[model samples]
Target chain A: MKISEIGEFGFIDEIKDNTLFNPDPVVIGIGDDGALYKTTQGMEQIAVIDTMVENSHFIIGRTGEWYDVGYKAVASNLSDIAAMGGIPTHIVLSTAFRPDMDVDDVIALYKGIKDICRTYKVNILGGDTVTSQEGAVITVAAFGEIEAGKALLRSGAQAGDVVAVSHTIGNSGAGLDVMLHGADGYDELKKAHRFPEPQIALGRLLVKHHCHSLNDISDGLASEANEIAKASGVRLVLQYEDLPISEELQRWAAASGTQAGKFVFTGGEDYELVFTMSSADFAQLQAEFPAVTTIGTVEAGPAEVVLCQGGKRELLPAAGWTHF
Target chain B: MKISEIGEFGFIDEIKDNTLFNPDPVVIGIGDDGALYKTTQGMEQIAVIDTMVENSHFIIGRTGEWYDVGYKAVASNLSDIAAMGGIPTHIVLSTAFRPDMDVDDVIALYKGIKDICRTYKVNILGGDTVTSQEGAVITVAAFGEIEAGKALLRSGAQAGDVVAVSHTIGNSGAGLDVMLHGADGYDELKKAHRFPEPQIALGRLLVKHHCHSLNDISDGLASEANEIAKASGVRLVLQYEDLPISEELQRWAAASGTQAGKFVFTGGEDYELVFTMSSADFAQLQAEFPAVTTIGTVEAGPAEVVLCQGGKRELLPAAGWTHF
Candidate 1:
């Protein structure tokens, strides 16, 4: 039938009826503001989004490593699902490029994606590729499933929970400084900045042991701690002396005369997990990995984050990452 | 312990162990390239992606209506899920804009998204918003579920199956012509161009009834027919006289001295569904909507699409849409 004969609404109804399922998974279908779905039994879903733009997110020429761009873009999203203590199954990617974008960069980018997908054994399924006016824009959406009622949240922290981080915090930050300043020889820090790994496995361990709360440190530690504090409605007191700083990061900071401690507190894009758990859970985790630090403690107080040592008290700078 | 003290690999190890889910929905965790997930029983996942760019995809000023841009962006993705005979559940959007983008325009753009999400009952789970160097880039990743055994692939057509379309064609192409020419009074065609609804219901019904191969008419019918023919390893013989063309499209074409038939066949972005089913299924679908025309048939010929009526036969135009 011609859609025009029945008008727009009639045409829409035809479209709607064509999608009806027998033993449907639909809780609600067309004619609403959103589609409703029946959830799978025994599973909760975890999702993550990552965005990459030309010039702003990554350089296209000279300093741009197109392969790493693709690798890290996918990693960033996967990390979020990992942060939530969930397993990822499917990923969708969207790429927008100007008409003039080199074909080689596109191939390299897809290679990076394929490499990661093969490693994770996740399917690409489908995605969008369109023409942009100028530079390229890439966004990846990653999805995973987890045990229902068990996916970790940032609001699960309690007073007396040991504030712990999965790994040292300042390497990525230091790496970024090295890159921006065009310095040399901190190859470890540079790699950390370009290809920081997300703590997916560590996240699952925390969930398995009934850890109180979990978060990925995509932003700096200070901002991440603030998020956990606000979400859980508690205060956090971290030890500056206990802040995780890599040897390479400390060396780079000393050579550059940059404050290594502040870098741990303020840098961004680390893609690590900053979490809290009971000392017992922490101890169990420590048995497996002795370097997991009990850096602070959750406390019953206003929703704020502070750092101190040597019998002094001070507020940590709100070192939130703001991308432009 | 500080991540730096343990080094990069050690930090990654800690991250990996932490995400390891006990009773893991995580079939695979960190150290892999992508995360692996276990599936929900009896269901298959369907995903779709839509990308909108500045200048090329939509005009940012003058003729541009930000609200419609937002609405159409979301609708386009939903339409793809519908095309696959799946029930859409979650949608994630990633938008890149410049620092100078007006706050009100952003509000209006989101309102457009809000309007459609409200209509569809879709929750905007979460997405990434980042700054761009130039114009706005919005990409949506939409997810849906279908009965695993029942997903309708593009390779299911068979000889003698009757070909059918869910609605009339050509209106959207005509609408675009009108908009580009700045002509007035063809609001229906214009609306068809600006806000074509996705055919979710029709897709579901097709799957439930066990139809053969199916395809959405995003490109012109000619290209879609070619896709089906190529995928299914069969040939399509369409009756040119039987093509569904709306009155508005006809009027616009007549006024412009454009062949309405060519518009129905060669112009793209119609967002209709074209499929082949048994005569029995066609009869069943037709009983509800008499306008469902048997415009063509499938046959054992070279894998190509031909248009014929009475004594005339010609190869269909290769006019599919292409993106860079």
Candidate 2:
């Protein structure tokens, strides 16, 4: 069987079962945003690695700049830590590129990385630089820390838990469309696609408020919700009208003859937090984070997601971006 | 300027100058096999990442099995921690490959990783698998731990220190030649190339023996020796006759009409350790590890390495493998 038959998540599931040889230090091993391992008496270290291949993740010169490529690479890894409600502390970066690549472009890439590291107070550790046969490949391995038992996992949602998102969804997806199709007026969408900010502060706040489940919107809300549902062995019911789609994305979708809800559900790389919590906790959190919008609720049922519109319900397929 | 103009080490030098945004936790940052950072009051964490591109590092199915590729990837990262005299505990693996690759082959790759992780008692934490447009790329980020002050560094060598290596050198280089040229009657050399072992035990022993500077022979003996000399700000005089050369490698080199010293000096990926220590400590370590061989001595002079043979001395240039 080809790996494409299994898909990315299926490939992960295939390798995830027998990975921990010495399981003593591992609090949470494979199949999470990051691996959580016991470090000190009351602290756990989270390690996550993400790789962006040329053309697969971004077009260096065309997407925005080499700086933007570097920025997005670090942002995506930081988002994983945010999904785990952890404080990112350090990162090691590996870049594989052609020898003929300009040194100034590489320096610009590092400048983007350095700026983000400074903003997050993350130290740049050591990494490898090697020659690639073709396009460049950048991999960042990020390390973070969280208090013991304070991590928000994908498997903690309970029936009646309210599902919410930290920011308006689909802006990035519309931004990508704008960049690709040359839609003249959507600077907000273009910037959203170019430079995403990981929701670290919101993640910490959710964990403090005892959020039940959390995921980062790297693979879109539909796929992320399905992951939470499967991991938690529950059903998610998302209200179609309740999804927080941005005005710019909606307007762009209307002008382009596309569905805004499609972007909200299946367009990935938003870098926003999607989480579940008790209704009371959601209410308390909404006051502190006014932009947080309720989109769904957890239910005790088969592991799947459903989208409800007006008076009809339909299954939400996990059609989010899969590499394979 | 193109990165190739400055070369791999030059590119590293370019990025090494300013990386640490938060300097408190960092004990050592760039320009080393691994980054060492303070994790707890008395413990430091060692993190290293290595990437292997398809044609650059290994050609799948051409250079042994897919298993060998996976094993070597993890082995290379583990070797970095070994160079730091740390106990490797965990690793995160990332792979970018064509989606049409066989699932069984990927499983075989993971089996190789699993086998090595079990042998070292290191846990497979988490990783990212993505689609690459071209040939496969594998990256491994390894983490290890060492006592606060017991970690060996490349800058600790002093004048009068003895330089030694844990095992005979150039076997892997010979093995690569055997594989590439289809040379017969050298199974040992082939095995050395296919499955190079990290010198973790020897590294631990060296640290216990208060060994000073240390490096793994991934970029040949001359390059590693030069790194030690430069980092420690001392001159090293290597006795050419005392350099350990395997009998098989020597015989093979003779049969192939190639000088065996060429491989000994510039053949990389050996994974054995080269280290320095006070003469007294070297004597003590030799008693415990009889295979260890003294090949050189540190001298008070400019940071450089000299090859001495038959009362003649010549400068040794770092003509090891550069990715470019």
Candidate 3:
């Protein structure tokens, strides 16, 4: 059967079931966005490899500058590290380039990657390259380190915990939609789509604050909330009206007759942090991070995310952007 | 300006020069088959990622069983770890598959990979999969560890060292040739092409014995020998007559009117270890490893490799299979 028929989510399930690495050192593997292993030095090693295929996850020029592609590539992996509240140290870039690609473009791509690496103080230790028959396939494998027992996980939320997001959501999806239609004048949205900033600082702060459960919004807020809920065996009740939709996304949603809440729930590639913690911790986090918005609370119930508003409660569709 | 115009060698040179890694932990990076780094635990971390594109380094059905492609993918990365004389601990497989591919085939491929991982006791920690635009692109990024200051490098050959290979050469190239042409026989050659075994035990043994410089014959004997000579700043005079050619390749070469020596020199995908060490060390290795074949000697001179036979000498062309 074709992969499109099987669907990316089903395939991910197959991979999770048959995952081959369940060694003693592996603290968590295959289920989350990244894998975690305890190193010999008593530190938790966080590893994540994200594959970005041309015309799929990214486009050569449709999204942004050549440098943006490179910047985003590293940024995505760093975001995975951020999900685990780790600091990236090493990366290996395995890229398959089209044979006829210009040498300068590849260099520019590398420069974009290097620029970000320079900013993050991570080293591009090594990588291998292959020639693709057509489009480029760039995969970045990033390695990070965190203090033992300090790395946050999805399976740690508790009942009565306050659910919050690191910042405003839906800009990336809005930006991408605008760009695809060639709509004018939303540079911030386009920038957000082109380069979804990795919330490294926020991740570190969350770890320090001892947040209960956390995951990055790579897919969508709803999907991430569901993940944390399912893994932690709790119910997440999201207040639909409380979602932190940006003014830009709000204006665009209004013009398009689309609910900003739905976009915030279903839009992907946001790269924000969705976390749950104690009310005190959430208060402290909101004070420290002015952009954070508490949009929900955890409850003792079935493992799912429910949207509550205006005396009506409904289970979310578990819908999100899957690669398939 | 196209990659084909720049050529793989030129592009590699550009990458080596513009490499973004030069940290205190990096012992060797970029230019070698794998990068070596000193970890905080004082162990040397060896990392290498190799990309195998469809119809380029491998074929879906032409190679052999569905498992051969997967087996060879992991083996290639293992070969790089072998080159460094390190013990592989973990691997991440990033594969791009055609959407029309069968789910069963993917499972079979994973089974093949799992078989090898089980044998080597290496963990398949994690990987990402993508939809291929055309054919499958399978890449393996391997990580290994060796005691600090014990890893071998292409730059460790001494002036008076004796050059040798771990086993017979040219079988993989000849096997691929036989497979490409419609031939039924030459099972050994076909096996060489399909499931090239990584010399893990041999590599570990060599490291224990303190082999000076080592490389794997992924791009033919001549190219690997040249790498050692160039990196070590020594002249390598390979006695063509002493080159180890399997009886199968020799017979095929004789029937096809191809020089067995040249086949040994230019044939690639032969996952054998090529090393240079002191003459005394070479003799000891030959005795311990009965199959070890000494084929050349390193001398103080210009950094180059020359093929010599019966007092006649000529510069060997620095040619091998490059993607471009």
Top candidate on TM-score is: 2
Kindly report which residue pairs in candidate 3 clash with one another.
none
| Model 3 bad stretches (over 4 Å) | A1-40, A320-324, B1-40, B320-324
Tens digits of lDDT, candidate 3, B44-121: 566677788878887666766668888888898888888888787777667777766665666667777877777787
Query: Which candidate comes out best when scored by lDDT?
Result: 2
Per-residue lDDT, model 2, residue A299, is: 94
Ranking by lDDT: 2, 3, 1
Give me the displacement of residue B55 in model 2, in angstroms: 0.9
Model 1: per-residue Cα lDDT at residue B310: 61
Residue-wise lDDT of candidate 3 within A1-324, one digit each (tens)? Answer: 433344334434432332222244343333211222334575655667777888887776676666778888888888878887777766777777765666566666777787787777766655666667778888888877777667777889999899999888989988887777778887878888987888988988899888988888877787888888888999999887788878889888787777777668777888999999999987887778888889999999989988886878888756742211
Residue B130, model 1: Cα distance from true site in angstroms? 0.7
**Which tens-of-lDDT digit does each residue in A1-324 have in candidate 1?**
322245334433332332332224444333322233444667866666779887877674423477878878888888888778876665667777665555566667766776776676555544566777777788998777678677777888999999998888878778877877778678887787677776777877887888888878777888789878888999989987887788898898789987777678777778888889999989998887666898999999998987776777787755542211
How much does candidate 2 score in TM-score?
0.86
* TM-score per model over all chains: 0.85, 0.86, 0.86
Model 2 Cα lDDT, one tens digit per residue, A1-324: 433344434433442343333444443343211223435555567778889888888876556788988888889989988988888877777888776666666666777777787787766665677877688899999887777667778888999999999989988888888887866889889888888998889989998899999989987788888889888999999898898888899899999898887788777789998889999999899888888999989999999998888878888877742211
Candidate 3 chain B: 10-residue stretch with minimal lDDT: B27-36
Arrange candidates, best TM-score first.
2, 3, 1
Q: What value does the lDDT take at residue A208 in candidate 1?
A: 86
Q: After superposition, how far is residue A78 of candidate 3 from its true place, in Å?
A: 0.8
Residue A215, candidate 3: C-alpha displacement in angstroms: 0.9
